[model samples]
Target: MAYSHDSVADIRSESFPDYEARIEDAYIEGYDPASLGAPHSSLHTRKLWFGLGLILAALFGIGLSVWGAAAHIWGTGTQIDLSNRLLVLGLIEVAVTLTLGFVLIASSRKGYKEYRKRTGRVN
Candidate 1:
């Protein structure tokens, strides 16, 4: 279904100005802005996608690393050597994966904060 501006009420809300400006900008560019949805600048969309992708990738990496570490430590199919260097390496992989996940989350949060700051919506 195509987007219609008539569907949205004229009653201004908190994000009305931002949305209005975007619509007006698109209209000036000879395009219907109704399809644009809310007030997302290109930079905002790119940053949001990047953040989401980073989070997803981090989650996958963390899960894979943890699984690999656990399989090494407790799986019966592999030779069990508690004092072996492989144990230490597996543990290190788990720790590093956790750290990477944390860092990705922090970076995503920071990016969101920066976006809010730029949009003057710091609250």
Candidate 2:
């Protein structure tokens, strides 16, 4: 193994056995478990935020669709027809949000579990 980044261009076949071990050690040492905790935890936070946002959006859309339907049914306020796409869109949003939220929560839990197992960090 060669330390040079451009080693691909310089094809010298003399093997340095220690280089591979040194590189692996350096890579492992770069991550401090005490400081970083678990790397996937950050990703879990992001996924949770995104999923909640989607859920909120879905709720808003559903509210809008219901309001429109109510207006049409009551025949008093601004009437949006039953054929309006808002109802369909709102239903789709709800399905998508629920699916994504479940997936994110499951994956994040698995990742955190794996990280804890690897680090042997029991808490």
Candidate 3:
């Protein structure tokens, strides 16, 4: 929504004074938008999309593992060695998939918090 000064609430929250350096200083001196679930001036559109893509990929990896297990694609065709083969493959899949998921979460959280701090916002 476009915020206009005619609105009373907008005057208080969306308000800024008529000065160039003052506005920049205000942002640099702690302009957090955590109430919006986002830190202000830290995340650009492209970076957010990239992070979202990483999370989507991790979820896809998990889904593929489930499909492989259910279809016995995780196992060798040999009748006798099928169980052991599936077990090994399943373990490998779990390890890699979980590791990727964890890394994605950690990296995103760290990056977000660091951005907030760097922009002078208190978490």
Candidate 4:
């Protein structure tokens, strides 16, 4: 037999009398109750690694673009050409990589600051 809505509600209320208060407390604490067991240091470290990885990838893209531009301009048996579609594409790639790297770094720094503030850590 299936429990009616009222019966379910009654059972829930009987089992958890302070559910509303607990939820309110969780809100005030600025985190979900389900995440209580996870350590904040792990989250911080993961963010650091993610930020570093993005920076490295961005740098790699910029380096590849620079290398391609140099090779196109200075390689043997190739005439020196300044005005080319490939140069424009390489410049665009550099600009995009720089923009993405800056944004990710800034956001990660901001998140680290917030984490420090939340955890009351000075260092």
Candidate 5:
């Protein structure tokens, strides 16, 4: 008589087709449970602070970029040609900052949800 054996990796892959992708997503979003060592509540608080910091920084960057762009377009006394170049650069900066802000906000929300689920909190 012979017995069959299956490896853990094989079992996991068969059970969850997207297991690796899910793990990657969790890490990329900064909510990997494996990386959390503190108590659940403490981890939640730290995650909140980290997420808030990112959002605040992004907001500040966006505000500065918008101010710079506005100044380049109307406030600056430079020549039209130079001003146009600066204006374009400033606009690009504003767009980049906006995108980063959005990404940060989304990451924050996703991480918060993950934290709630892990802690079994409804609110």
Candidate 6:
């Protein structure tokens, strides 16, 4: 008797794949999860600070845009409509910052989970 096995699932099922998530998971799995507890969490503190800074900067830019709009800077000669674009650009900056913030938050969560899984640290 002979038996055969397929190495991979059929392509038609690709639509249901979790490829991107799996890739991200694989990358995260390569890290040392045992070092994620409190004292060691400091390793990620810098990232948190950086992320905070980004959010602050984005907020500052948006504030500036709002101020410009309130002041009607776009109505000024030669600068007309410029403030509108500036505001739009500021909004874009905020959006990007928000995205990065979410990513950082998720990474932190993954880190904590990994730490718990590897070192039995509960937090």
- Tens-digit lDDT track of model 4 for 1-123: 986776555776688786433222344444543332434333445455665665666665566567667767676255555435455666676677566766666665674476567656543
Ranking by lDDT: 6, 2, 4, 5, 3, 1
Query: What is the Å distance of residue 89 in model 1 from its true position?
Result: 8.7
Per-residue lDDT tens digits for candidate 1, residues 1-123, read: 889999877776644665434223333433433323634333345444554555455555455556666665677475554334444555565566556655655654674466456555422
For all predicted structures, in order, the TM-scores are 0.34, 0.47, 0.38, 0.42, 0.37, 0.50
List per-prediction Cα lDDT, in the order shown.
0.52, 0.60, 0.54, 0.56, 0.54, 0.62
> Using alpha carbons, what is the TM-score of model 4?
0.42
Tens digit of lDDT per residue, candidate 2, span 1-123?
659776455345555333433222333644544424544464537776776666666677677668656555565345445535666766676788778877766655776677567655542
Candidate 6: tens digits of C-alpha lDDT, residues 1-123: 455556656787786766443222443433544445544363466666666677777787688668567646436566445666667777787799877976765665665577568755454
**34-82 in candidate 5: lDDT tens per residue?**
4355333334454456655655655555555566677765766654435
What TM-score would you give candidate 5 relative to the actual structure?
0.37
lDDT of 5 at 31: 49
List residue ranges in candidate 1 displaced over 4 A. Answer: 1-36, 40-44, 76-123
Of candidate 3, the 10-residue stretch with the lowest lDDT total is 39-48
Worst 10 residues of 5 by lDDT: 19-28
- What is the TM-score of candidate 2? 0.47
Number of the top candidate by TM-score?
Answer: 6
Name the better of 1 and 4 by TM-score. 4
Alpha carbon lDDT at 95, candidate 2: 83
> What TM-score does candidate 3 get on C-alpha atoms?
0.38
Off by over 4 Å in 6: 1-37, 40-43, 72-81, 117-122
User: Candidate 6, 41: how far from true, in Å?
Assistant: 2.6
User: Per-residue lDDT for 1-123 in model 3, tens only?
Assistant: 998767656464457756534233544444545544553332444545465555556555565556556557555455543544554565566566566655655554665576556556555
